[model samples]
Target: MLVRGKADRASRPNLLGDLDIPSGLSASVGISEFTYRKGQEVYSENDPAEYVYQVRKGAVRRYKLLSDGRRQIGAFHLSGDIFGLENALVHRLSAEAVVETSVRLFKRQSLENGAETDANVFHRLLSMTTKNLRHAEDHMLLLGRKSSVEKVAAFLLEMDGRLTSAGLLSLPMGRRDIADYLGLTLETVSRAVNQLQREAVLKFIGKTHREIVILDRLRLSSFDIPG
Candidate 1:
């Protein structure tokens, strides 16, 4: 069963409104809000795709486990990002909170029902799916063809655009999480970051390794392989 709770006014702006889903649809179809602690599982792979989620605060990591006990992270969803809209009835990847997180959940069945009666809802659903597809395609390119340096550079640029504040890119996940997402080992990711720092491309801040400042945007961009 979907847990029910009130979504504060502060979090209203981060809901389905960004996807252009009618506000009326949320109340009429029933929306649930869930709060998860850091490293907690939001949902597991092959679980029923009962709800679509929008991050209200913090970050989420979507990943898959291999038969041989290895793991591959697909993406990290940040605040205001929607995820878990699978094409089938089950989620292919498991999602977990990278930090203490709150998310607004929409019943997938209710959403599908709304799409049947509303053209706008249908269009928005299609648009969201297309956006996910494009991201997957880009990730595939990065995993399949991009060099180690290029992959790390692209990752930094992505986080810079998504999470940078006051000139610092505060990454919510650690090196191991980043390595899984980029299909590289932890040592390789560390070396790549160190190389970039050595070249004055970026600088680390504070004691935690999660915060960084991009000193040369153009130099960073040079390392990204064009698709």
Candidate 2:
């Protein structure tokens, strides 16, 4: 189980907390929750997009498999974050648990029906869709234009904001996951992180690569490519 600090209480997972669920439809929507083991598939690419999911605990990684069988990770969804809200009928990427994860699932058909009769539900759907679009746009820029060091820098800064607790950042994914997400080789990602550690920009916690402490946030940010 994940341990959270007092400062993280406001961001803790609460099903429907970020969503505007219409009152009358709440009982009829067929909402259910399930747990997925670490590295287990939540859904595969091209699967019918029959449900929307929100992370209640742990983390999820969404990725696409190319024809050559190479994997490209798109994004990581943390606790309280909603995902699988694709516009297409089929999922464009597959999702898997980075750790043992719990998620709340909503039947997409039920949600669509609710949106048809409720303005609030419709607006909420639009807002969630827009948020996903903005993330995708930023990811595209990071992958296509940023240098290797810049990509790694931006990634560290992102995780620092999302998963840091008491000034220590714990990464749920491995170096390979980070490499795929940044469109770089695993060695390159490791090199970038080691360089940061040597420069005193960040320091590793314990002997694990997954835990880090940022020592110089300003110096780290300086390496990130500007928008």
Model 1 error, position 95 (Å): 0.6
Pairs with steric clashes in candidate 1 = none
Question: Per-residue CA lDDT of candidate 1, range 1-227, in tens?
Answer: 23334556774654556555667776765667878888889999999999999888889999999898888999999998899999999999999999888887878888898788778888989888998999998888788745788899998998999999999999999999989999899999999999999999999999887999999999999999665
Q: Each model's TM-score, in the order given?
A: 0.92, 0.91
| Best candidate, TM-score | 1
List, residue by residue over 1-227, the lDDT tens digit for candidate 2.
32222334455454454457766777877767777889989999999999999888889999999889889999999988899988889999999999888777888988888788878888888988998999999898888745788899999988998999999999989999999999999999989988998999999888767889899999999998565
Which regions in candidate 2 have their CA more than 4 angstroms from the true location? 1-13
The candidate that achieves the highest lDDT relative to the unseen native structure:
1
Tell me how far the alpha carbon of residue 192 in candidate 1 is from the true structure, in angstroms, after superposition. Answer: 0.5
lDDT of 2 at 134: 94
For candidate 2, give the lDDT: 0.86
